[model samples]
Target chain A: MSMPEGRMDEQTIAMRVAREFQDGMIVNLGGGIPSLACNFVAEGREVFFHTENGALGYGGTASLEEADWDLFNASFQPVTPLPGMSFFSHDEAFAMIRGGHIDISVLGAFEVSEKGDLANWAIGNMKDYNGDVVAWIKTGRFPPAIGGAMDLAAGAKRIIVAMTHTTRDGSPKVVKKCKYEITARKCVSLIVTDMAVIEVTSEGLVLKEVAPGLTPDDIQAVTEPKLIVADDLKEVEL
Target chain B: MNKVVASAREALADIFDGAVILCGGFGCVGGMPSTLLRALSELQVKNLTLVGNAPALGLEAQKTAARTMQVPESYADGSLLLKNGQVRKLIASVPAMAIYRLQEPFPIVKALQEGQDIEIELVPQGTLAERIRAARAGIPAFYTGTGTGTLLEKDKEVRQIDGRPYLLEYALKADFALIWAYQADRYGNLIYKGTSRTFNATMAGAAAVTVAEVGGVVEPGELDPEIIVTPGMYVDRVVVRQGETG
Candidate 1:
C-alpha cells in the first residue's frame, strides 16, 4: 500500500495531529505517541498544555546550560515553560482535569474497541517463580492506581486515541472487543492508527479513510471486527 | 474539624455541593482517607469533580485480574458516597479496567457508549509528590522534570531547551484533604506505615484544610522527629481509628 503524504513517519503523524488543535484549547498529551503533537503546533496558537507532574509554562528540550534538575515532566524529561503559564498543587492539576477546564486530552491507548472503549492501564497476569496469578503491570503496581486515565477520559470532552491499529502479530487493532481490560467505557473519540484513521461512532467503526493504496476492503479483511466504509471515501491525504 | 461530621449518617457535613476534593491512597497500601469517602456517600452530592489514583474496589477483586471485554466494577468508595445519593457528578482517573487494562479503559468506554462525561488527568508518581510539596510550602508553583515530551505538555507554559517539549503540571491544593496515616501525636505530627506515604505526605500539607485519620494517636514527642514524616505545623486535626482500619 502506498503511504499517505505527511503520514509516512511519526513526525508526519505529529504534524497531522496538530491540525486538529483549536486555538485556546486546553489539552493533555499522554506519553509516547501523544507527546509528538507538541512540536507541530501552529505558531501563535494558544493551546495550554498541562503535565500532570507540574509546570504550566514548561516546554521544549533540556539544555545543558539551562537545565534545572527540579524542572521536568513525569518521565524525568526536561521541560521549557511558556509565558502566561501557572502552577498549582498536584491536586490542583487533577482539579483542572476534574473541573472541566480542559477541552481535549490526546492520549495513547493499548486496545480500542470498535465501540471506542479504551484500556490504557489494566494489568494482566505475570508469572512468578511459582507461576502464581499476580497482576502484570508496566509500573510494578498490583491493584495499581487506575491513575489519571479515567479522570482524563471522563473530564475531557474530546478524547483522541493514538496507537497502532493492531498488535505486532498483524491483528486488527480496531477490534470488535478488546482482549485486555477496559478502563473507560466507549471513551474514545478518534482512533489514529498506522494503517487507517477510524472514528468510533454509534454506527460502529466508520472507516474515515485508509492510507493511500490500502482499500477499505483491505482494511476490513485484516480487521477481525466488521467495519463500515465511508461512501466516496478517498485515500487519507496529508 | 470535628464539626465536619458527627456520625456515619452525617459524614459529609463539611463538604459543600460541587466541592473538588482529593482522595488519598496507593492501591490500599498507604493510608487512604476513608472518613472523607464515607462522608461523600453521606452527603450524596452529585455532579462533583474528583481525582485520585484508582477507584475504590472491594477487597475480593483487589487481587483478581479483569477478564477480557469491558467490566465496570462498583467503586467501593463511590458506593458509600452514592448510597447517600450525594454524588451526582463524578470524575476519576480509572474505571475498573484502568485498574488493569491500559489500551482500552472500561468505565470511560461504557460512558462513551452512552456519551457520558468522563474527565481523566494522568500524573507521574514522583512529580505528583513534588507538586504537592510546592503547594504545602505555599509556593505558587514549582517545576518538575517529568512529562515534558509526553501527555503532561498540555496547559503547561513550556520551555523548549533541547528539542523536547516539557510541559507544566501546576501544584494541586484542594479545598479539603482527607488522608490516612499510621500514627500521629496530639500536636499533629503524623507518621505512615510502609508505602502509605505515597500521596498522604503531600496531601497532609497541600490542602486548605487537611484532617488526618490515624491508626494510633499518641502524645506529642512520643515519636522521634526523624520518624515523623509530616510536622504538626502542616496538619490541622487528627482522628484516631479505634481499630486497624486497613
Candidate 2:
C-alpha cells in the first residue's frame, strides 16, 4: 500500500494508539496524547481506567454544565464515573502504580531515545529564550511539572508512547539519545506516532509499520537514528 | 450530644498563625472542605504551611439576580492562602499545571513568580499520598523507589533493596486536617460521595485535629455502622454546612 500524503492528525494518532488497549487491563492515561486516547477505547472491551488522582472506573469527559467538579480525571478534566467505581487515597493509588498493578500506561513525550529513555517533563533553555527570560530570570530555571509521569513510566507493566512524529519545525522526536531531561530509562515498549509504529527492542528502534503513504526512506529521512525495517512492515490501520 | 458546629468559623476557631494544615482536594474538586477554607481565608491567619494534592480551592460562584454570569468569590484552596500571604510554605503534588508558555497563570504559579515569602516542595503524587497515610497509620517512615534517581531524591537518603534503589520518605503530619464529607452522623462518622472522598478518607486522623465540613448531618444511628470509612475518634469536629452561618 502507498503511504498517505501527510502525517496523521492528533485524533488519528490517538485512535491508532487506543487500538493497543486490551480488555481487563487497568490503564493510566497521561496528559495530552494519552488523555485523548481514552475516547477511542474499543467497544466491548472491559478496560478499567485508573487515574493517579485516586479514581478507578472513570468514564468519558463530561460537558461543562453537566460537569460535577467533584468528578474529574488525572488531566483535571471533568469525567464521568462508571458504576462499581471506587476511590482511594494517594498512598494507596501510588501503591497500585508502584506495585506494578497497572497493566498499561500510555504517555506523551518530548523525545524518546533508541534505547527507550523518555523525556517529557521539562523543556530546558526557557531562560535563554527572550520571551521567557523575564519570568525565569530570578530562578534561572523553569520548574518542570513532573506530576505522576515518572511513577507511571517506571512502574506500569508496559509503556506505550503516543505522540507526534516530528516537531512543528520538522525535527524528529525519535532520536539516538534524548537531549532533554530523562523521565525514565528504558521504559518504552511501543511507540505509535503520526508517521510510523516502532517497537523498542535490544536491537534498537525496529520499525513495525509505516503510516499509509509513507515509505521506509520517508520515515528514515526524518528519524535521527538508523531504522531497522521489520521483515513484514505493514500499514498502520487508523 | 454531638460534635456538630453551627459555623465553619467556629470549627476552625482554634487555628493560629504558622499552623500546618492538611487541606484535602485534587485540583480544587474533590475532598475539599471549601466552607472552612473560605472562613479561614476570612480570618486571614498568616504563615500557614499547607499540605495537600492540589493548589486551588474555590468558593461559591457569585451570581447576579438574572443569574447570567457567575464570579468565583473566595479562596477555597491554597491559592487563597497564598494570595493573602497566609502561606509560609506548601507541600503538595500536582499543585498547579503550568506546562506551557501561553497558558493563563494559576494563582499558585503567579504567587511563585512574584517571589513571595513562600516555599513549595513538590512531591511525587503517589509519594505525597503515602506520606500522609503513613502519618495517619503511625508509621514514622517508609522507603519507595518512585523518585530514586530523579531530582526529587536529591539530598535525600537512598538505600538499595533487592538491587533496586528506594528513597526514604518521612511521614507527613499536620497541626490540623480540614476535609469534606458527603454525610456524617452526630458521632462524626463520615461517608463521602464519589471522588470527593479521595484524600479525605486517608487524612482523617493524620493530624492533631481533624475537622470535617459535611453536606448533611444525621443522628447517631442514621449511618450504616458497617460502612463508615472514618470512625468518630479520627474526626474532632463536624461542621454542618447547610445549617452553618457564613
Per DockQ, the best of the predicted structures is: 2
* lDDT (tens digit, per residue) of candidate 1 on A1-238: 2355323456555555666788887777776677777767788787777765444545664555554433444333445567787644345566666557777788777677887877665443223313221122222343223455666765567888877666667776677776654555667888776667777889888888676667777778767668888786776655
Q: Tell me how far the alpha carbon of residue B48 in candidate 2 is from the true structure, in angstroms, after superposition.
A: 1.5
lDDT of each: 0.57, 0.77
Off by over 4 Å in 2: A1-5, A64-66, A125-143, B57-75, B99-104, B242-246
**Model 1 lDDT, residue A8, Cα:** 43
Q: Model 2, B99-142: lDDT tens per residue?
A: 43323355566676677767667677777788889998899999
Chain A only: TM-score per candidate: 0.83, 0.90
- Candidate 1 regions with alpha-carbon error over 4 angstroms: A1-7, A61-66, A123-145, B1-202, B206-246
